[model samples]
Target: MAGSLVKRQGFGTAPVFLTSICTILGAILFLRFGFAVGNLGLWQTFMIILLGHLVTIPTALAVAEIATNQKVQGGGVYFIISRSFGITIGGAIGIGLYLSQAVSTAFYIIAFAESFSPIFNYLLASDFNILVYNYRVISIPATIVLILLAIYKGADLGIKTLYLVAFVLFFSLLFFFLGTTEYAQNMESIPWDAKILNGKSFFYFFAVCFPAFTGMAAGAGLSGDLKNPSKSIPRGTIWATIAGMIIYMVTALKLAISAPPGDLAADQFIMQDIALWGPAIPIGLAAASLSSAIGSILVAPRTLQAIGADKILPNSFVNDWVSQVRLKSNEPVNASIITSVITLIFVIIGDIDIVAQIITMFFMVTYGAICSISFLEHFTADPAYRPIFRSKWYVSLVGALACIFLMFQISVFYSIMALIIMAIIYQTTSYYKEDKEGLANIFQGVIFQLSRRLKVFLQKADPDSKEDHWRPSVVCISSNTFERFSAFNMLRWISHKYGFGNYIHLIEGYLSRETYKEAKECVNRMVKLSDSTKSRVYMDTIVSPSITSAIAQVIQLPGVSGKDNNMIMFEFSKKKPEGLENIVDNFKLVKSTDFDICVLGSSEKNFGFKQNIDIWITSKDYENASLMILMGFIILGHPEWKNARIRLMVLSPEKELEKQRNKIRELIRTGRLPISLNNVELNEHKDNIEAKSIINEKSKDADLVIIGVRTEAIKHDSIGIFNGYEGVGDVLFVNTNKEKEIK
Candidate 1:
């Protein structure tokens, strides 16, 4: 169905230019510019024209840039958007765009009905009792005729009709500019700032005028019928946009000079009185309105057909119906019927004030999305995105921003409603459709570029600014990853906030092709595991020959947070401490880098509910006390530990217990730590008592026990210091390289 338009010889640039220009100078120019000039004055009206072009001009440039970069298929704007941003997000916006285009058919048809007002007034005066009181007499027939033409004759008839209307529109404007009124000849000087009293506000008029510029993309809707969309689209769209802006500026000026502000404000058809041939104004209005309606009728069905072809709708049956095309003529018959139904329903409603605002919001969102794609492509600097016609990044940025700003500026309620509708559509499509290509696929490249730039900036910053406060930049190495999750769990808690963590899975083997492939699988497994837990730790794999060699390689790895690693963590089971010797042997090498160390001794309980944490501090462990407390605080920052509490247990001689208790209290207060005084306990220990027995007896109920590790003990081969902790669920032995202040 989408390729139906490509079967023919295809149109040249003429239809593209005619379709857009006709819509650009349609009902708005004939019906509303006089009102704008009267309310906002000539200078302010000029500003409105410029402001509208601010959005349209950039959008034109963006469309040109994007069309040149890729093959634009049946959907036109929808095709360009879905291909760049992925189908799900693009489908969400495409639905809105299609509805707006469909409803616009009715909007223009109703305006065309307004052109019958002069005849209706004459009928009412002569006592001709027909349906002259109701404008639907004209609207309903006009709508049926147009729908029949679309269903039978298709785009071929629509393009031919556009050419005739475009000619009438141009002649009407010329006659209005040529005529000279008494007000213009008698005026001493032009009133550049003349406006009627109690007129509408600037934004109100802006909302009324902005849609005129939106027709610049009217040509893009014919992309499927173009011989070469990459060349014809840019040329037709840009030329129409500039021509429309210049014509509008001149039209505003002519209206200001020809008519008084009072008459212009009172009569929407004041151009009739100003023109040399008075009847030409109403004739032009009727022609422009019909042309725009025909343009919309031609474009809306193709958009719906393209969407159905992509299978974006939830129901397969509906998709099949909408995507069906006429075999010989290559026309979207079913889609045209749907578009007609939507248009007729809105036509019956007649008063579409609220609906019009919503349509405006939809157009604004589409324009913004196009500009965003162009800007992101520029930012990513992807080789695949090279376009022959390039738009400046700043121009695209301004266009995107203006669309968003003007959305709320036009109507805050409608803007929010439009966004909510798109979100709902996106989620619904995502649930029924399995599309891996999504907004994330595009953002991935954008995030990579951003991360690279930030890393370089941070690396070049002054080092002194970073040393004032300390946060953990931890690196964890493990070979028993599948065997236990304690190491990974710790990494997640630390990396949750205020820190960074990188976990490397150590495979104790030489690097081979098989090993490299296995390492990639291991990384994928780790990623799935991390995603399941919503963990923030970055995962990787290293295939080194020995645990010591892996540890040496892992320690040199930089932190993902763009900081140097300051802490290293290792894990082993308490029941089987086979990996402890290798870790102890590499302590000297880790110490040479001045990195703090944490060795986890896990048990069968697997941290046991994560409720209670016990931190044991001794008089001889002054250097490790601050780090141990900080680690506990950092772990508590994770939501998994939300209900958990920490107990700071201190051991000293009986005489010095009071001194140590006050010192701990002062540190907690100064650091603004969450620990209460009641949770801090002081204990008396004699010289004969061993530290292991005291920990086993006191911390039996603790889910986790944090105990200080001394360099002197490790150097002297005091491996007994880490043994005999069967009572506790898990134990973390913390060693600090230097004293860290609480502040």
Candidate 2:
């Protein structure tokens, strides 16, 4: 069968509203309404109802907003949650929602048997002990019958039955209201006490009463079945909540005024005693329980089907099995059977109060997650998160907080248990191997917005105020580092000085579509290399036939204005490439763009252990001294070079050498190079040959060499073959473009 044909939609607005009403106005109203009124009195009973709705209203609004934001499918709450929070959290909450619905089916079926057992009490052969034992035994068959009816008839029959049940429920309420009127008139004779009647606190009553309002999710769970879920869900949920609230409040008022406080507190079957016709009470209970069971059974299996269809859970066999549908009915028959089996287990256990508490805890977490998604979407201000059903962020925040607060208020142990189960499920689902493409959950948007703001703030902050504030903002030509990985490694090390690096890959060809694709692929490879090397480098590719023009354009690449790339670097090959001369001629052009330049010459031998760095200084190259010293400090800051020694060597005549050494000392102090004056080496040289010989002899064993490069050296192609440094370690030739002294 086709997938589309297997997922059927038939519900309209009226059926959805009636289904929710029937679900919310379940057996609790018939069996437990007097318990609340008796224990908490008229005022507190109304307060509990109001508090419950306060939490649910935001959750309903959140659901409405999310439903309208996207196309909703079978999962209902699970669908919304998974779409908003991703599969892991969605799967966890999906399981929680499924279990809640399954257990809720049993809860209502047990209520049915509890109410139905009274009819058998009048049988001559049955006694009280038989009533107690047979009530749970009867629930097993009652649960099976409801599940079977749902499976055979499908949701259409369930909706029609809910319509009749809703009618009968209102009819029974009319008689209840009529019977209470006479007793209400004699209000002065009834004792009204608002205290702990049965050793249960206000919050305990609140927990039991809260589930009465949670049936709102029944309409939402029918999202896939609805004719127009986005339109129907908001309308049905809001109307049902309002209707349920009114019914609960009016029932609370009637019960409070009609019965003596002692009878309201002590009698579990107080509604039957107060009914105009005794059978009306059991009839209402039966209708409420059966209707609620039908709604829960309808919703539970669909939730399981959604989880299975999405492949959020680990077991693929279970996922495939539960997601299967009957071709003719287009119903989740397999999923329904699974739900029925789970419900049967709970029905046999038949502990109503404990079941209610557990159900309440699960719903609280589910509702809180919904509200939290809405709150995050609004606060994160993601453009894609525009929801048609607009709501305030603070309101959603309050709703989320209220749901969490009530969870603990109900029972801290159960609340903790719910959270632990969800966390474990989330962790487990996170390991599921699935391609999560085109999925952007709300938390991603939140992190994105925060990162964007932080980036802006960082760009505005001054980076030159202190040594700690200094960070490398570097741009290197890709041609200089391709296959010459030592150059890329140096760039990585320099960029590790706490800032950003960008690599520009300029394709020296006509800018055609194929060239653009090739350049893009090259940039991707470079980015992958950056990842493998654990470096923070961004790669950009440009196709331009003229390498010089590309370099010129790259030097002016726009960025956060003041924090743009402060330096441009290139590699000097031993045998210069074809465009090396032209690139050298454009050095002044690059300087005009306000970026300093550094050309690297990698040794044939690997850069040996990074134990020593040597900086060769000349009288004419004083302008590059501070930058070279800063580079040495930055290199030493890296972990691999942390113990590396830095020595400043001046090969001037002895008379001028002390003055040059003193100047180097002042530069070290001013630039904060973290080196001692004893590391400065001054040697006498009579001519350029002697100076070159002195550098080769003293720095031959060093791991790295730093020297100044002038335009004359580049014009002669002597930049790579620095005098007396042919067999040395890695070399860096610095040319200062800025006039400011290092401070």
Candidate 3:
């Protein structure tokens, strides 16, 4: 073993202390993905990571002093602030901290979701470009399965799962670092030599390094529930910060030596570049990333539970049993679930980098506040108040200043967003003074307690409002038989996932007039589904309106209640709608009372896993179509859409509109048409050469691309889209249909 003996007893450290170390590791790992900032000069990166240790040390010491001296009554941020400053400030801090941590978990889940992109593409196909695949289909299943697993088994399973994840990450990163190459080359390329940044400019870069220091604070965020927070919290905080700094320094040094800043920032996982380090490093790095993701899954929920326990959140949110060390697994079950749900929404919003940058800004405010307090405490001159392991006040001051300064570095847009978050918290907390406290306390912790109560009350009063899915359609019938309800059930799931609203249908065709009169009895039984489901339904009796123009008729009526957003669900048969399906050359229509004619297709059959559903892209559509092709490509490449393994590309021109994309999907279905609803980007995308290049890259591994003749003549040297201008010969490029085996 080429190991230098570094002492670490797996079980020796206080649980919180160990937690801090792991926490810092997780933060360091955060720097390894999605929208990484430039690696400042070598010396700058080095100083921040190295000096970051000195910075976090003061707050850790201050926490120890307060936790030990203040008589652990509550020992949370609220308690810490009350003892140091006052209760009012503590209350505000409490609320803001809760939100900070809540939003922070979003970063974790987002990272977790993004980290799996490699695995997702690996499972589906190689060269997983953003525009080519759908990660939602891949991640949603994993997230849903995990979420359901967590909710079903309660909190215990989630915790146990996290522990396993930690172990995997530790070993994996170790191996990746060992395998990575060009370390010497990277070291030689340092932008500047060793010159420390002690001036004001430190702040912008400080923001870059702040996450390195926050690891200890992360554990402190969990102080209320720690096994022995006083001793444990101090040890964990101090050591974790040191470890984080070391990681930042080493990783920065390693990265600086290995690649240029431009390359480093772009790679995200610079350590996992297999072309440079051989393939083994990627696996190891992946393992490490997995570990960090799992840790977020475990600890992120606890902070929410802690907020609940303090009586800010609903008591129901604190359903877990954390009083005993053995039952800590049950401590914050409801809060965990809630956090998970909240995180899921952010994940669905896409863009992980934007979410993370916003989080860094949000949390920096809290970190700066904490560090400032520590600086204030450094001068109190009380023996008991002195930190067990205190550093100079200057360190804390720099940390605070750095935090303030770094907050500015995170883009003007994010700065505004961070302020908005702060404003929202202040407004909500002040508007509802449920948790009465003072600002002299811990910053905004008071607001936290009050907000929790209001949130809990709101939840109880209205659970339906929180449900983001569309309501299930009820096809009124006499019985709950599957044959009678299959269409309703299918539409309900599709509507829920795709945001399509419930469609109320009164069966009026095929049978005699007498039979149609009898169908009214069947409506009652069919409508039985709405009672079991929360989805909304429009009650339409099709007796008088003998369905004529299915497409045109459905577009004229006002949408059913709560079933509004861009989606209208209907119960039409596969063999049934000739009136609706035909003449509707550009789309399909059902006889309903709503008119959003641009709306296309029925409910997505495989809404979650949309990969098997082929998309037809032609050169012609690229020039004039309305959609963000790049974003679509990225969404399609999401790791969540694992089931979306097969993507067929049809490169026809004249059929470049919606009709063409749909027809290509028809080609893939082979007969009964196995696919999801047409997922076109409502927004328009340009057909520039650069965009085309990206498309070709996305289409590189495509299963099939059906080509149609181009409207214009093709130059001998140029490639042309078919079925547009005019052409006898057309090129059909099915990726899988290559003469030579694709390697």
Top model number, TM-score: 1
lDDT (tens digit, per residue) of candidate 1 on 1-743:
56444375378888888888888988899899999999989999999999888899999999999999988877788888888888888888899999999999999999999988777766777767554767898899999999999999988888889888988998988888888899999888878999999999999999999988888888888887777988988999999999999999999998999888999998998999999898899899999899989989988998999899999999999999998878666678999999999999999999887898899999999999999999998988887888999999999999999999999999999999999988898899889877757577678889999999998898888755748779999999999888899999989999998789999998878999999999999999999999999999999999999988888888888789887799999998899998888888899999999899999999888778889999999988888988998999899999999899999889888888888988877877886455788999888888798777888899998999999989998888556768878877899999999977666
How far is each candidate from the true structure, as Cα RMSD in Å?
2.4, 6.0, 27.5
**Candidate 1 positional error at 340, Å:** 2.0
- TM for candidate 2 is 0.75
> Over the full model, what C-alpha lDDT does candidate 1 score relative to the true structure?
0.89
Return the TM-score for each candidate structure: 0.95, 0.75, 0.48
lDDT minimum window of 10 residues, candidate 2: 433-442
Stretches of candidate 2 above 4 Å error? 1-9, 25-55, 69-73, 79-96, 111-135, 168-212, 242-289, 308-320, 351-433, 440-470, 494-497, 560-563, 574-584, 604-724, 733-743
Q: Which residue pairs collide in model 1, if any?
A: none
lDDT of 3 by residue, 1-743 (tens): 77323222222234454445555665345344211224455675666655555446656666665666554432355456544654334445555665555555445444445556566656666554434256566455555665665456643454455466556655655654555455444455455543223323545555554554565765554454444566666676667666666766666655555555566656666566623344334443433334344444445555545434444422333323321122433344555567577667765775665666666675566666667777666544434464455656786788788666656664677777777776766555444344443333333544454556565665466533634322322222111233444345434433344324444454545567785766666556546656567543433434323444433444444333323233332232222233323223323232233222211112223232344333445545432111212112323343443345434343443434466656545633663222333433221234433333434444434422222222222222122221121111111211110011101
Off by over 4 Å in 1: 1-6, 122-131, 188-190, 463-465, 668-674
RMSD of 3: 27.5
- Regions more than 4 Å wrong, model 3: 1-14, 27-41, 48-55, 71-79, 82-87, 119-132, 145-163, 180-213, 259-266, 274-290, 313-330, 378-392, 411-743
Report, for all candidates in order, the number of backbone clashes.
Answer: 0, 0, 100
The TM-score, computed over Cα atoms with residue i paired to residue i, of candidate 3 is 0.48
